[model samples]
Target: MVLTDTHTHQYYETDPVKKAELMQRCLDNGISRLFLPNVDSTSISQVMDMVDTYPDNCFPMLGLHPCDVKANWKQELETIYAAIKETKVYAIGEIGIDLYWDQTFLAEQQQAFRQQIGWAKAAKLPINIHCRNAFDEVYAILKDEHNQELRGIFHCFSGTLEQARQIIDLNFMLGIGGVVTYKNAGLDKVVEHIGLNSIVLETDSPYLTPVPYRGKPNESSYLIHVAQKIADLHQTTLETVARITTENSKIIFGI
Candidate 1:
């Protein structure tokens, strides 16, 4: 079965030697697709370069991540939009609110989020959101601005079942990753009630590594562990989990 990591930062590895080794490991483990989300103006070139090296296995997205949103966010967003116009990105992503880290840029984060959503709508591409500690704020924006033409995944989702339902109702998929594997994550309850079709698998790597590898730098190859955990949570075989998640990923990314 083919397993797809719908959100990953494999491109974040600057050391070419290490990056190649990690990517090969992923390919060897049947993780065929890796989608790279843009953080800001700084990482777009790096992401594009990595996709260039393995065009078939990697896809690039363009956006300004919430954490990166600052007073100069408008200029940064202009750069992101220009890049999207120049290249065919897989999606508009890694963009959303993050209140956990700092609230200094909360207003700017909301503006950037709404701006990116408009870019996604205009470009006719899906989005990959990176929300944390701002579910209510993000949901409120979505509720007001979301349209039938707007769709994407809530990457690294660790929210309640009601939130999951709201996301799905808005025609966006929930991105499930290593967080579900945490003993006290509580995502298992959400998954048990929400069907797998509303979900997609991701690693968010070089971060959020699953059990046994938690606290270490994550890689796409470790996606197997995340998938296995989901399979067990659903009482199904790994192959079934891989197949369905991959299909769900295709529906979201159109890849």
Candidate 2:
């Protein structure tokens, strides 16, 4: 059973010994594939470090997270877009409107989101959205920018069935993470209805840790738990979930 973590920040662990142990645990649990999305200019090195250490298992993506969108967002994009040219990135992502934190930067966030979407479209790559309380804002931009080149995952998706369908209609995959394992996250109901073909598993590690480890930090090794939760919700086997989701990852990332 080969499982894929479509989104993770396992690179945050800079301690070499602990990093190796973390990767070993992932390998032992059959989580062979992990996609790394760098949040901003500062995180590019950490993301690439993991990619360099595990070239075969870790894939890199470049983007400035919405929460990281400050007054210097233009300069941030200049650096991030330049980095995209230097590296072979699978996607331009972990980018979108995040109004959950501060509503002060809504305009800047929308502008940055549009510009990043343009980058993805121009690069012929997918995007990884990080929407929070600004789904409407994000969705609006997505609609305005919708086209053949507009595609990617809605990372850490925890929306309603209607919203899931709307995203599916856009030809993007829903990135399901550890939140689905929460007893009352209400994502299970949506997952139970959304077909597996439109879904991909993620851990978003160092955050959104699944149950049994909800209070602790998350890692890619815990991806199996998310996969298992989906299997249970869909009434399928773990192996089947692994196969289908990994295949979906390959189709999306083309790797």
Candidate 3:
């Protein structure tokens, strides 16, 4: 049973000892393939370093997160884009519209989102979206960019079934995270109905930790909890869930 965490910030653990410990836990639990997303220019080194350390286990993605859009947003994108040539990135994301933190940079966020979408198309790579409180805004752009070469995962998805349908319609996959394990998150309802092919598992650690460990910090190793919950929702075994989702991840990341 090989579990794939399609979206995770596992690079946040900087300590060599702790990093190895968490990674061992993940591997011990059969969670070997972890795809890392860099938030902005600052996190590129960390994400790449972690991948460098565990090349066979970790994969890299570079993007300017929506929340990271600021007055110097253009400069940040330039830096991120320039670095793209320096490394082989699997995707161009966790980038999308985010109005959850602040609505102040809405326009900048939209422009940045569109710009990144262009990059994704040009490179023929999948995207890892970071949408929050801006589904309509994000979907509008996604719909406009829909094409044969346009594809990606909607990271940290905690939305309605209707939204899931809309996303899957565009040949994209829903990135189901720890939120699905939250008793009151309502994502389990969505997962229960959506086709397994349209879903992929994620932890978004060290945030959105699953139940039994909800109140504490999260790690990629806890991906089993998320997978177990989904298996329960789908009335299947953990191995089935892991296999289908990991295969779906391969379809998206092309690995």
Candidate 2 lands at a TM-score of: 0.99
lDDT of 2 at 124: 88
lDDT of 1 by residue, 73-171 (tens): 999999988899899898998899999989999999998899889888887899889899999999999888889889999999899998999999999
> With candidate 1 superimposed using the best TM-score fit, by how many Å does residue 213's alpha carbon deviate from the native?
0.8
Q: What C-alpha RMSD separates each model from the true structure? A: 0.9, 0.7, 0.6
- lDDT tens per residue, model 2, 1-255: 899999999999999999999999999999999999999999999999899999989999999999999999999999999999998999998899998879999999999999999898888899999999988998989988999878899999999999999999998999999999999889998999999999999999989999889999999999999999999999999999999999999988989
Give the clashing residue pairs of candidate 1, or none. none
lDDT scores for all predictions? 0.90, 0.94, 0.94
Question: Which structure is stronger by TM-score: 1 or 3?
Answer: 3
Q: What's the number of clashes in each of the models?
A: 0, 0, 0
Model 3 — which ten-residue stretch has the worst lDDT? 176-185
Residue pairs with backbone overlap in model 3: none
lDDT at position 94, candidate 3: 91
- Better TM-score candidate (1, 2): 2
